[model samples]
Target: MFHKVVVTLLVVSAAVIYADVYEPVYKPEPLPYYFNYNVYDDYKGANYGQQEKSDGKAVYGSYTVDLPDGRKQRVDYTADHYKGYVAKVSYYGKAQHPKYYGPAVTFFNQYGNGYH
Candidate 1:
């Protein structure tokens, strides 16, 4: 029983050592690419655009969109293994909203009640 235990321990140690020394035969290289798109729909009141590029190590991009409040939102961003991700946001044009008033009373009784 002692001999069997010793043999099993030796086999396990050998496997651990071999695993530590093992290395992949092939390493895939990063691919670089770039893309951009824009959209403008006057009927739906939609306007936006985005562009991005990467050279394996780092990525850079920017996007812009029209806000419902009549303002344009813009964002510029960058990312990499070292810096991770960073973004700078800005707005263009003033925001405008229509004045709000209480619901209209189409019909009312003389007593100021909604029903007669």
Candidate 2:
């Protein structure tokens, strides 16, 4: 029985090695032949032979202008090419009021900088 088991193991190992080294691989078909299924042949422009485009108007533009006071003014505009475009200006920067003490800072200076 031990001799039979040893013989079986040796046969399996030799068969695995021979199959791995002697297997035959089939070559892949050409690219053009693979697309000859006749399914996409009836599709319109399926082969990408035609170019299509529509005449559409895209009127959208914006520009930012830096003010002399270290602020930026972003102007956005839009219109049709046949008509006209309109733009509005916007300002962004420091506030018109003081930063720290606000309006009370002026009164404090006038009263000798006293908290009372």
Candidate 3:
């Protein structure tokens, strides 16, 4: 039994290593694919490509912005992260935009400095 356990661990470790689990692989299919009610997070983005209501305060956006090629980005400043379509992704260093300026769903994990 002890030997079996060690062998299992080795196999699992090898599988995990071969799978490359420690990288931020960004897949474009989710951004480029069309959105519909049924497809859901079946793609990417926190929500199922649908904007959601947060309690009674924040309004969020569906997927982070997927800017079309050759367009100016307009990133909205969240708690500490900037989000929006690639076209609307604001890349201003140290620049921040109020969450209220954007839809509420984008606040899925909006928090920083002192708040959750």
The lDDT leader among the candidates is 1
Model 2 worst lDDT run, 10 consecutive residues: 30-39
Q: Write the per-residue lDDT of candidate 2 for residues 43-63, one digit (tens) a residue.
A: 442211212222245345555
TM-score of each: 0.67, 0.30, 0.23
- lDDT per residue as tens, model 1, 24-96: 9998877899999999999999999999999988999999999999999999999999989999999999999
Q: How good is model 3 by TM-score?
A: 0.23
Backbone N/Cα/C clashes per model? 0, 0, 22
All candidates' lDDT scores? Answer: 0.95, 0.54, 0.41
| Candidate 1 total steric clashes | 0
- Scanning candidate 1 in windows of ten residues, the lowest lDDT window is 107-116
Model 2 spans > 4 angstroms off: 1-55, 95-116
lDDT of 3 by residue, 1-116 (tens): 99999999999999999888666577443222222242324255222123333322233333333232323333332221244322224522343444564444422344443322
Report lDDT (Cα) of residue 20, candidate 2: 86
Model 3 clashes, total count:
22
The TM-score of predicted model 2 comes to 0.30
- Reference-based TM-score, model 1: 0.67
Residue 21 alpha-carbon offset, candidate 1, angstroms: 5.2
Pairs that clash in candidate 2: none
